[model samples]
Target: MTQPSQSNNNRMVIKLVAIVIGMFGFGFALVPLYDVFCDITGINGKTNPYAATYDVNTDVDTSREITVEFITRNQSGMVWDFEARTKRITVHPGELNTVEFYVKNPTAKDIVGQAIPSVSPGTAALYLNKTECFCFEQQPLQAGEEALMPMQFYVDPQLPEDIKVFTLSYTLYDVTGTSSVAMNRG
Candidate 1:
């Protein structure tokens, strides 16, 4: 009878200690854990989760019709819209051209958003190229008003001398965007 009572008392102490340690671990993991959750859900930050891959022949002077795409994930109660200045463009290898990315606030009130673009290798990007990008600048859109953001870029015949294929990917995220990373040379 004495042995059984001591065993039960020890088990209760062990359980209490386990709960306390578990809570401390949980508290310590809060910040990192929240970051992971935001990354997966696109809540705290926006990322280019997907990009369309395309290959251009830098050897020839031709026109390329590349569709830039925008995607939002796990958003709640906000409507966002995006458009491009031109759907098709013509350029020669080593010649840089400017393109546009248009974002709109479709809601009844002013909406702010950000755009992040990732251009493929052997290509460059510029802000002037976008007629309406809310990326480098915070885009504050009035209800039903559209803005054009621009990016200037081109494919270089000088791409690594060994690379032949390139792709550009853009991902727009966050109700409030905070980053802009660019590739300036082909």
Candidate 2:
């Protein structure tokens, strides 16, 4: 037979094991739970927010036709189409890459609005060489048409040095659409 002190010790051990199991369960359930929270709040930058802090620039590199794409907001009633010379490009820091941005209307009818470009995860503007494009300004494109856009950029030779590659992504959004503060084209 076990002494009372031994029985008490055994009970404590069992309780500790149960607590550990509960902690693991909580840990396993947290990832998906956090995702849902981010989805709703856009704290993850997956959707647009009520007030976004970014820059807007509209300029074309008359010589280079760099590619740009329009990624619409979630189930919101909007769409995007992009036209550029290239989608995948590589260049050394401080080297200029002429990027052309073209905004093509997706709707059959003319839609007048602005295009907000954002760098996903959490970063400020599109940086190239000596230029910082913080999402540029509001653009007004005609319906069922295309507009030429440009971003003259060069990699920052001092981009952490250890960083060899980075994809300059453009995520197009409409002011009058769902928020995709987290979902970026990164």
Candidate 3:
């Protein structure tokens, strides 16, 4: 009887350990899984990181106007002043448009910053084609330096008829430390 009891306890312990390990594995997988899900459903406004090719022959749908609103933010610990020069613009579908953003380094030292962009009404991200954007590269600025960043994009004419407005937001982060480390390594 004692032998059987000990055997049962050992099995229970092993089962619990397996469950914990499985839970940890699931936790590690959640991020990539969520990204995949978002990519498929267009849930979190994940925009493509590559430049979009524009066809000059594409017809501009002048009748369909979309209101695009620009917003900006600095990540916590980032001290740079950043803003979109244009707050909002009305654009015709399939017609190219441009907007400029302003950034200044107020700190006394040079810093490298990177911008991450997202489009709200998330589904519209798929149709928002960017041909040129500052967000594509890390921006390095000297102290007291100011620069104008431009973004050129167009909305696909095939966008759903019910969607007439979308918001494009950029969050800038201070990546000076990592960038410096990489540069040193090189």
* Top-lDDT structure, candidate number: 3
Check candidate 3 and list the clashing pairs.
none
Please tell me which predicted candidate would have the highest TM-score against the true structure.
3
lDDT of 2 at 148: 74
Candidates' C-alpha lDDT: 0.51, 0.50, 0.92
Identify the runs in model 3 with alpha carbons over 4 angstroms from their true place: 180-186
Q: Which candidate do you rate higher for TM-score, 1 or 3? A: 3
After best superposition, candidate 2 residue 143: deviation in angstroms? 1.6
Between candidates 2 and 3, the one scoring higher on TM-score is 3
Judged by whole-model lDDT over C-alpha atoms, candidate 1 comes out at: 0.51
lDDT by residue for model 1 over 1-186, one digit each (tens)?
Answer: 699999999999999999999999999999899977765643442323332222443344344323333332223544667656565554455455667676777677656655565543313322113323345554556667876777655444443434333334455554544324331212
Write model 2 residue lDDT over 44-137, tens digit each, in one string: 4332323322233433324333222323232244465754455666554445556666667767654444544443332212233324332454
The candidate with the higher lDDT, 2 or 3, is: 3
Question: What's the CA error at residue 46 for candidate 1, in Å?
Answer: 13
Q: Which stretches of candidate 2 lie over 4 Å from their true place?
A: 1-75, 118-134, 176-186
**Cα-based TM-score, every candidate:** 0.44, 0.45, 0.93
